[model samples]
Target: THSGTSLGGGDDLGAYFGLGTATGVDRLEVRWPSGLVQVLEAVAVDQRLTVVESGLLAELRPLTWPIEIGSAGGSFAYRLGVTNLTEASVEVDVWLHIEGPKGVSITRGPIRRQLGAGSSLGLTGSQNVPGGAPSGAYTMTLKVGTFPIAEQTASFSFSKRRGTGRAEGGGCRPGLGRKL
Candidate 1:
């Protein structure tokens, strides 16, 4: 919405002596995408677009992936924190997809689940932490899906300390991203 007014020379500011002044008006015109043009009698103005909610990106946070390995076998677990951007309740499918390190094959864990509106889903699913897994960087995917509503993703890296067997924090990037 815009409102503008023009100042006539009648309200002269520095007009004295011969007392002659000038007033100027701006002409506005817009061309629509449909090849239609619209002209209006107006002056200079300002315009912009602001996103008020639904369009805003939701907040997605994932805890570092925890992995354990021993004689009893190995296990993995991770959690997701969801912050609904919309005022109303929304459903989100948050899950983990872990790829086993070279020479190690994981057969279980990592599944899909939903999140409640304006809330988050904390998942602690147990999975086999690959044995003799190379103690280097690991690639993991933490995804949140809300069909017909919203989709969010968190891609991150975590390191495993061989002797201590603890995972370090390397938070993922924010935003619902491109495919895969």
Candidate 2:
């Protein structure tokens, strides 16, 4: 059995079942805490399997304007839409990460929210880009769920305006974004 402690301690949550002289099992059933059930047939033995829940969908939509950065800094805003495809309300965690040129990475949140069945929620926010950041392509990634049930990415670029000493660029280019 898998167990844990509530007193700020750690426990191994892994479950191991030994099948003597058996090469495989006929079926496996997993009942999630959220009341979702999954079944696997003809399962192979002696290997670790990672199962991810698939009751949510996420999409990332960046503003269609160029990101303008002045001497001090600038901010870019985006909208993330999440949909619950299940029949019941489910709680999930959302995370946003901005990765820029030269290994500059910024994390926005692990915001937790609950979505009703067949309902959608839009999360809007902005992220600050520091002054003098490298001029190049950047990527914004959105991840949803406690175990990453869905993910999407959007791309943008930053370049110095000719003779203006400022940086400006656009994301959400046509056919540039993709889901993962």
Candidate 3:
């Protein structure tokens, strides 16, 4: 069948297998030059299959984000959790964007840390509100790896000094609305 019309097994042309019928190839058999016989079942026609000796692949996944917000003394505190899903360890950077009254915005630093695969890291931080600060609502955005994961808004106002306690009239108190 090598009358120059053969489809394969020639010099630098590689080996090729052809199915003559239109009923779709149900099975394929391969006999390697190393005297190893392999059979594949339920294979369709005109489809390609890659055979690898040692199976190895690369996997990429996004990190998981969970956040919690609460009051820490005179400051607003928050706990952020980051879960890594990659095969290798990854370094994560955390950023905070705070939007307050009168179009005030505060951008926090790029807190960098290493996170192992399938492990989670918890970070606790507080945003201090200075004494006699304005009474208004604030929005805190948590950004992980250049993406906004979660946002929390809380209102603050100055309460009247009722008793001789740490929470004086000068300190800011949590207002009525708080959304997690």
Candidate 4:
């Protein structure tokens, strides 16, 4: 009613709304000062919709991940892929929690990054496994922007087959990856 203590012009005197974590909106109704009503339906998220003689409606989309599994060690890197669908850009913070054999657990940082609007990002980082670490299963969980994204589990077993001329694993050649 323009009776509030707002410093803006008459354009800011209308109604405002906010929706959190909602996927879609079925219908939105608006009433003008001239006693005319307008309704909009089937609106999608992460978009800016304009209405004639009415205010603007906006929606935000959440982040998504494509490749969820990866191998982490000195010879290979842990990869992450994220997709942003919102109209504006966003920053993604990465964190890691690793559970190794013999009840060992490690926590990594809150790395921050800026993501473009409606774009995807792929990043890779290395992880260190101690030489004395037992040969067993290892788990790595990833968190994007402080939210848990995905978890990858792999078995770690090392052996020396260079002298015998027999490879241990498939699709991987020895001395091909980054050395420690």
**TM, every model:** 0.38, 0.53, 0.40, 0.39
Across 2-64, the per-residue lDDT of candidate 2 in tens digits comes to 456423344855556789999998766666676554545467998987666567666766564
- Tell me the whole-model lDDT of each prediction, alpha carbons only: 0.39, 0.60, 0.44, 0.44
Tell me the TM-score of model 2: 0.53
What's the lDDT of the predicted structure labeled candidate 2? 0.60
Candidate 1, run of 10 with poorest lDDT:
48-57
Clashing residue pairs for model 3:
none
Alpha-carbon deviation at 68 in model 1, angstroms:
8.4
What would the per-residue lDDT of candidate 4 be over residues 5-110, giving only the tens digit for each residue? Answer: 3345444554445679989887666666754344454567767665554211111111222212222222234445555546777766555556656677766665
Alpha-carbon runs more than 4 Å astray in model 3: 1-73, 146-180
Model 2 residue 132 lDDT score: 69
Residues forming the 10-long window of minimal summed lDDT in candidate 4: 55-64
Candidate 3's displacement at residue 92, Å, is 2.0
Error of 3 at 99 (Å): 0.7
Residue pairs in clash, model 1: 90-117
